[model samples]
Target: MKNVLIISGHPDLQNSIANKTILDEVATALPNAKIRKLDELYPNFNIDVASEQAELLNADVIVWQFPLSWYSMPALMKKWLDDVFLHGFSHGSTAKLGGKKLIVSFTTGAPAVAYQHDAVMKHTVDEFCYQFETTAILCGLDLQPIVYTNGVSYSARQTAEQIAGQKDLAKEHAKRLITAIQAA
Candidate 1:
């Protein structure tokens, strides 16, 4: 099995329902995968660049797991990319991250239908992710198809039974993520 690295970018993991559920399921399903909770690691947003680079270098498959905030990743995740993906290491002649597999998995408060062109957001999730895809291309990483869980906010004010159903949905998404990782 390939070494898998999960970079979890949830800002408030404790209060999260979908992200936390998905993470728990992934951890249980793939015991060998290394998970780094970015917010926990850098609460003050002070990233240890060398350590982050080391983790990336050691893994074959890298998963960026987060809750979509304002149609993008959390602030710390953007900072992580800025700090760890340096010119020489992630790109340029000395690039060490070339050929690594990259998978982006995220939870969105908005329903999938909201991302349709004629819907409220007026754009698809994939359309909002062009920057990430371009980053993978520039870094020479093999970008995998995105995995996302939508309608998460719909469960916010739900009853106990409804919340349980949301958890089940997260579990299913986690299973799909595991399948994607296995394929990678």
Candidate 2:
């Protein structure tokens, strides 16, 4: 079985509508995949570096799933990256994370249209997510396109529409990630 690790980074765990839906669907579809709720595990923001590295060392694919806050990751997720992805463990000499595939699934607080250069958000989705993708590349890991949804201004109707669309999107993305994992 392919080992997949899901790192959820949403601060408000209870109210993440889109993120939870996608993760649940992934878990159901890929029952063998390991789901690691980072926030729940490290609420005090103290990450066990060795243990986290061990988890990363065992996974074929690592997924960073989170909601965009202030155009970046939540403080704890950034801290997790800082703490867990150490010099020797993830990218340096030891290179524990090398050869692992990386996928970033994220949600934004703005409408999709607003991500355009001329739009209110003033930047494209890909541009906004360069840091995460670059990190994977630097670690010698294959990277996938970042999945994003505009959650900020979405109304009930819009949310329902997006929710309906998310099922297929999530499955497709999961299939792509899984295929890569198996191939690796």
Q: Write model 1 residue lDDT over 1-184, tens digit each, in one string.
A: 7999999999888887888999999999899999999989999999999999999999999999999988888899989989999999999989999899999999888889899999999999989999889999999999998899887875463788768867887898899899999999
TM-score against native, each model: 0.96, 0.83
lDDT winner: 1
Per-model CA lDDT versus the true structure = 0.91, 0.75
Candidate 2's residue-wise lDDT over 1-184, tens digit each? 6688888888766665666666787787778888888788999999988888888888988888887888888888999999988777778766767787787877776767878989888998888888887898778788865666664323533556675665455456556545544554
Those runs of model 2 whose alpha carbons end farther than 4 Å from true positions after fitting are 152-184
Clashes of each: 0, 1
